[model samples]
Target: MSSPQSRFYAARLAGTPVFDPIGESLGKIRDVVVLPQARAAARAVGFVVEVPGKKRVFLPATRVTSIMPGQVISSGVMNVRRFEKRSGEQLAIGDLLERTVTLLDGSGRATVQDVGLEQNRHHDWMVTKLYLRRIRSGSGLSKLVSRGQTLTVDQSGVKGLFGTDTEQSAALLLASYQDLKPADLADIVQELDAKRRIELAEELPDDRLADVLEELPEDTRVEVLTGLDSSRAADVLDEMDPDDAADLVQELPEQVAEQLLGLMEPEEAEDVRRLMAYDEYTAGGMMTTEPLITAPETPVAHCLAMISREEFSPSLAATVHVCRSPLETPTGKLLGIVHFQHLLRERPDRPVGEILDADRHTVEPNMPLSGVTREMATYNLVSIPVVDEDGRLLGAVTVDDVLDHVLPDDWREQDEPPATTGQIDLSEIARGIHDGDTGSEPAGTAASTTTRREGGRG
Candidate 1:
């Protein structure tokens, strides 16, 4: 029999087997669902259970007769279907565990190591507290030993969890996500509900929002863009890379696309419109208009400053196109190409024209995808400039853009393991605390703590 005081951290319950009174095995615990109400301990609603043969079903907490270390005895009733997240429901292990969060105390960020749930007098389980581990830095054994100091806080003390709370100010919330790469942040946002996703999109700055939008799938990108007001959507689109902006606008309905294009600056809109004129599979369609260019007589110092000032991507900045007069827009009369490396090795005062590689290869904007791939492969180039018959520079295609065209349509939809702080062993941390392993000190001693407010339901 389980006592009312008995408790289990979410990490300990995950993967534990469930069985019926007669000892017949039913399934394993996959996730614990709870309702996230503000200022209260969240109530455990049920378990997302994985039955044998790989089917996942929901087993309500009411059907759970007893909870123990390694097994849960249940009344055996369950709904046989895929688990879909509801508006009010949150998963303790699946959604909250290992998520990055900020402490209300103004100490820096920490990862949620585990959530503490306890059985009440009525035999109901409620989330009572949270276990946190600080972000750490080091290498080898020292890194393992000095890993984050662990602390426990009542659920009320958590100021915010990245991508989960929309009520907090955007600047505060965005600070937590800044450490995550745009692709990783996009994955987290995609898991959120439509309403939450829209809220997040509204709060992010245009540049940051553009980066995330570029990483999202075409369908999701359209949905998010459509959800925003026209002016804001146009601002975000304008901030995006021209190639990416063109691709996104092309997916929008003609009326909506035209409206957004009109809202953009003339130069920016012209760049996108020019690319849109080409077939999506052709070199012209896949190129970016932001390649580095300079006159042959331009000094190496001037070129270096342009690259640095513009913050051109590594591939685009790797080579500089040298041309005739009117250097800003290289004319079809191509002169030579200068690798960034060669420019650096020469005297800063030297003219780029003297060091240009006259034999550099170039591709036509209308070239087929296959031809582009072969040219890139043959020359082992990171970026190939696109030009017209007049040898005028149009744009450049990067290796990443090429892969995006060649990869499977569902490549972005494939499941990726959730990101986590790899420093601590969660199960071991839970067991050590439960067993009172002072010597091992899985998490550092609890310094300051806050207890849940009495009688409030989270």
Candidate 2:
């Protein structure tokens, strides 16, 4: 049995397998439910378990016998009803995770990364504190501050400083959404209605919005972009990966697309135009126009600094393309490539040209999708540079774009249920509870057991 002093993190508890005393698996925990009225030491009433077929079931916390890493032991008897949200019930994972909260000490706002829970002497689980990460703000600062230190705070601090009002909570919640991974944020957006999605998009900064938009399905992406004002939409598009931006613009009506392009800054618009000119299924269409490039004679330290200063994605940062003199746009000539690993091993003060991968492979802008995939597979490369016949660097196609092309259209829509058992009709269970037909004892009866435990511990 777990002790009253034992503590657990909400992130660690999520998806833990639950099993009966006899070793029969019930389900996996999806979310922890707490009553908001309980305030600072909110009591955790139950868990939302994910059963098979993607259905969710609610399990009262009292039914749990023991909690351990990766597993939960149950008393063998559980209500197998579908889980439904009751008024005033706050979910640790669904409601609190990723929500933003203001610090009492006047420090900048931070997003809730996780929640801390501890069992009291009464045998009741309570919310203890929150894990927070600072939000990065400003143009081109997202990637620079992508990684931040985490801080922990107790509930009393939150209520005293952050307020308990709906508007303040909602604002913080929306702000915290920026910290979520693009894929995770996209999943949440897909589950919301059009109005709510629009509301969320309005709160996100352009760069973050661009990242989330790139992860969304085509229809959802179009809907979100169309919902924003033309200028805002153009700004988001400008911030998006060039290939992704082109794909979106191609879906819009010719006039609207043209208007958006016209609104975008010339350099950004030119990049998109270059991508738009290519066949989407070809190498040119799938490549990002913003490949990291530097002059061959540039110092290694300078190259590293540039890599750190720019907001290139991890894969793009993996290799730096080397170009000859006249290093500006329409790069003088494609010289070679320098893998980041090799660059890091060399003396920082040395010129990058000393260690160029002169024999590096290259692909044409017009190469077919299959050919491009074969080339990447053949070389085991994460990114491949695209060049015109004159050996001028154009752009680079990333492996992620290739996977997106080859994967099934509905791949992103597959159901992902929390770790647990099979499904049951929740309405039937609700009816049973209403008619007093459920074989389980009333909640008050369960509370008495905990009350006794509390008295004994005290």
Candidate 3:
């Protein structure tokens, strides 16, 4: 990153075509990883690259070539494949994510999508830079081109997510971007000091700034609040989840938070204020105060109809909680979680309870984040509802938020074991290398052993 005074920002690379060894075209960039330059580190620690028309793929600062106004060039997609091959084994999802892809969108973490896997006729399997689309859906930054002139792809003149470049290689990898995916864009903003945060915030578009602000630490939120106008600040908060908005507002001085909330819609601001009463680190705090709640008795069609009226989409309808009473009066109680996949699986006439996660593990209002984190692991839950002493459903905790809890600050540098590393003892390790653990591992290895170990490796 360059000094704020400097017009050029080394870290805010908006456009750069990533390449594979043989010049295979990958995607253009969205944002730079822009890690905190902890203690005079010559290079950035992480790199956040929004694959044009895809999710942000994090590259290490080591992979960065040059950071410019409209672009950031990077290196190392080739290395991902080579590293996976040398180990002579199958890589885990986390292994592919070991690349330092930062979520510059402000959310702290991301997920692994499709790993660039290739299998030869000889059955040699190689893992590559899992071309992640997005966590849930693909949507990220677009590369900036000559004013009004976007990069067009391969004579088609069709622009990609970040716009496409001509003469693109067929091997170009792209990922998805989803509204639910968590991004580290907040951490990047936090990494900057007050002045830089403001400067960077000013440079970013309002929508992008809104996301980064929502994702940043509360204290940073307080510091950055002074940078934007009261209206702008309120607008940013308005665009955020009510819970996240409260989180940021709580960080500011009481007067400021109050003032910003005042600027917001009275109902939304009130909801955020109610959420602020609880400590953010706890279940009461972590769960959203205003989630899409409705009565289980409500006809599915009616509920869906009402859902279309909601300001936010029912995209997270899987986690859409239901109760017998209205959201205000609160009765009946949380019957179950409605899994979108299941809802779609069953006929619309089937009750919501039938589709709800019968076995979902919920956290109490006072439960600590630790409990929430543990449940996240135990159930592999995408979202967990938080209830009160009466077991009344409050809000839910989604997986993207928990991802930060799973990974360290320098997660990109973390080394993950191969799929067979767990099963690899002295003998199995050698057998895995020579005999092949890429699925076929002597079917008679005992169903129980394979069930627990083979699946565990995955």
TM-score between model 1 and native:
0.61
Shift in Å, residue 333, candidate 3: 2.5
Can you tell me which runs of candidate 3 are displaced by over 4 Å?
1-21, 26-208, 217-219, 301-315, 328-332, 351-357, 404-458
Candidate-wise lDDT, in order: 0.75, 0.75, 0.48
Show pairs that collide, candidate 2: 27-420, 27-421, 28-419, 28-420, 52-421, 82-426
Task: For model 1, state the Cα shift of residue 2 in Å.
Answer: 27
Please provide, for model 2 over 18-84, each residue's C-alpha lDDT reduced to its tens digit, 9 standing for 90 to 100: 8998988888887787765443577778787766644566677888878887788877665544455
Q: In model 3, which range of ten residues has the least summed lDDT?
A: 446-455
Q: For residue 399, what is the lDDT in candidate 3?
A: 58
lDDT of 3 by residue, 19-57 (tens): 544545665654322211224211123334444333344
Clashes of each: 5, 6, 25
Cα shift from native, residue 173, model 1 (Å): 4.6
Off by over 4 Å in 2: 1-172, 175-178, 325-329, 416-458
lDDT of 1 at 334: 71
